[model samples]
Target: MINDLPIRKIIHVDMDAFYASVAQMDNPDLKGKPIAVGGGGTRGVVSAASYEARKFGVKSAMSGRLAIKLCPELIFVKTDFERYTEISKRIRNIFFDYTELVEPLSLDEAYLDVTENKLGFPSASLIAEEIRQRIFREVGLTASAGISINKFIAKVACDYNKPNGQHTVNPEDVLQFLADLDIRKFYGVGKVTAEKMYLKGIFTGKDLKAKSLDYLEDHFGKSGSYYYHVVRGIHNSEVRPNRIRKSLAAERTFNENLSSEIFMLEKLEHIAEEVSKRLHKNNVSGKTITLKIKYSDFTLQTRSKTLAYFVRDKAIILETAKDLLYQNTLNNSVRLLGISMSNLNTKPQKTEPLKENTVSVQLQFKF
Candidate 1:
């Protein structure tokens, strides 16, 4: 039985269309319109889309050109991370007042452990509402929250209601809440993994739980064990206050596919600078420099070089990235280039961008 597990009150707070909403908040003219934040030029990729834009099938990671095709009146605004960060800090302050056990997943989302909070409130649902209301009053933005017995459930619940809403799953209802969930809705199950589940006759959490642990392990390896337990309402992961940074990265998607290494040097140098600055900002350095290349045909390749000592200098990062880049032969026309440093010297924080993971048509790396 999962009775031994502690029933912690967890809340996942996610700002609705954070980047786009922030844009609309600052500029009244953009409110209630089909506005997109970032992805402005012909080759730009959308970073965020307003609900109006979403209704038109416009979405983040979509090509701006295609987003315009979907919503003819879609407006694209530049991404101002500095402004977003400033506003995010204000939101974090509100979270801190409730509980110091706040784990920021990103600029727009976080997990708060309110099982025992500073306010000593017993109802997480009410606290979530109050937090949402505070965000609106102070930051002029709406936030949706999901409160549950654990982080995974809370994360999934937070997305149940879209903009300006909240959902709660009591401890007793956790099993039913998990059972009724679609296989794809499982937090860690991506598109490929979901497809794998469907092929294996696993269509829902109930179907997933029907299989024996041995059966799952035989098919999905360690992840099989993970799925087996989480479906049974048994995620024991705690809300870690100090989430260590795994890697720091900076990347750029070109308007046109570049085939020459000579043409890539300037771009790589710029990306290295961005990655180095972030490492310094965190007061950490890493020894492993990985160069990520995305081909025009959508295949991915990574080359890594580890040094004897940690380094965070732009020149060092640039040189190392260059070494790894030139180490391999150019396979095809390169559409994107990224620099990432891992094996960090210090235990850093959570939420550094993994820019190389996306292959957007116009996902430019602009601050």
Candidate 2:
């Protein structure tokens, strides 16, 4: 079957409590203590939590305030983006050495396509083990890996085992694993969607597969088509080596066209505001701002400007977008307005603070 099927070997790699582990690795005294990353302050949220802290019900995305309530001994540290990025680059280089098909989900996670690789290994599991060992020996970090024939199953398999563990799901087991899995565990089924599916009596893959495509589309819209593919273990999403963004924009199309300039400016301001918010959240500032306009007759035109410096401020985005809008003629009635930012500036350097650990959290089993 492996020889007959169009099989491709994929591996998912994830760092274990990456930020907290890196901090502990650097400081010996904090070895066994319950530690968290990204929130010592009242308002900050926990970005990562060690297994020890997780035992107390502390998890990522929970507010530091609540995390402390769960475990009073929890230690929190601010995020050091630079250190993490540096480690990420090192890991990425290692992946490229074997193959160029590396798709990073984040700094802490990635999927590597090794079906045709430089190492010429017979099994992907062997390659995964080599990658994990390389990360530990070279980067002073522990990484978990999952080996499978595709991204969907591979990603789920990686989480099966905890820190420094590896798992595999062959082609034969893919369907059975997906069939018995909780609907919540399926990719793209978040908390809200999971609740909705449960309400519809779709608790497992089999439950979901039992429904007709038309029925799913009627209830869940386009997601129904997506679910159809995943439940059958047939995902065609590719591992992009380098994904680049040409433009990032948000737009609104009103059902009715208006001639009032004030209302038009207000709508543009709102779109610009959202674009600015997203830009700052990604820590990217753009030098180019473009405005898109659509007339009631379906005629469209765009105007753009290149700025001297990168900016992601709401006021700046609005001011620039307004200027571009005015530069173009508003001959016909307007139906839609869009704003986009591009030509990103250099990323900010992140510095991790080094702390002296007064308490040592030791692994009872020993390293």
Candidate 3:
């Protein structure tokens, strides 16, 4: 329990086209062009696409075929998960220099709590600028930052000015900014919920605030309480450091159906390599390997394998995933393939004692 609340300072940092930008940075020819990284075959899925591709209605998660159809000249490159994961670590190290209260949402997005920074800085925006400069200089990637009183506002502010931009939302301005915001802009409201709100005449935060909590509860159930508080600029989620991940998985939905087993194996290898890289970076190992396949008709099936000991080796991961894939021979042509590792040993020990055949144990997992 922490008392004596000081002025809250939070910042959200998001990389612009993180995956695609990394690809573009490495290959100058890709710059300013419609480029995507992921599976390349007709059955390949896009892991990330540049903003230029987005202009042509190309988006991540759209089947690779649909993306190419939307942008005839779209360039598809294989994903380099190893490279992106390395850069993510470098950026994270930069965050630790100012404050340890960092919560990474993914490789490209994170929230920093700098209410009490080591540098004794008074303004969070200054710290944000320095971090952005460091990322560009050190990692060779551009990052946009948002500074605010809390995570929610900061995240929204970051998106407001994207592609290497920064914005700060003060406590005093929270209400005005949120007032005109569409109800859909609220974090938890999805397309379905937004449509529901629209039908109920809830167009903006002001309209949302007019409804009673009981009324919202009747419609949205438990999440309604969250909507009520968020509209009033009241959120209480703390920034935690080094949070452990329970599972790591990567999946791709191809643009076209794939009948060739060899092509599907190549895609799985890529996903497996990425999942393994993430596991190794976190110093975590998994005992379970899961392989998922989706057919042209959208039917999905999953297979899993459990190991006796935790492992993080990429070769082992790929081998296990390959075995799982072979076990579940596809009845229908595969449209999507995914490799995931879970049931991880949340705690990892660096050194193993040779005292006994069973080997000594060390508590390395940090909560």
Q: After superposition, how far is residue 272 of candidate 2 from its true place, in Å?
A: 12
Candidate 3: regions farther than 4 A off = 1-4, 250-293, 301-334, 337-367
Per-residue lDDT, model 1, residue 92, is: 96
Candidate 2 clash pair list: 31-361, 32-361, 32-362, 33-361
- Greater lDDT among 1 and 3 belongs to 1
Candidate 2: segments with Cα more than 4 A from true spot = 1-5, 246-367
Ranking by lDDT: 1, 3, 2
Error of 3 at 222 (Å): 2.1
Most TM-score-accurate candidate: 1
**Candidate 3 local lDDT, 82-165, one digit each (tens):** 899898999999999999899999999999999888898877888999999999999889999988766777888888788898
The TM-score, computed over Cα atoms with residue i paired to residue i, of candidate 3 is 0.77
lDDT of each: 0.88, 0.82, 0.83
User: By summed lDDT, which 10 consecutive residues of candidate 2 come out lowest?
Assistant: 358-367
**Which candidate number has the best lDDT?**
1
Evaluated at residue 290, the lDDT of candidate 2 is: 91
The weakest ten consecutive residues by lDDT in model 3 span 358-367
- Sorted by TM-score (best first), the order is 1, 3, 2
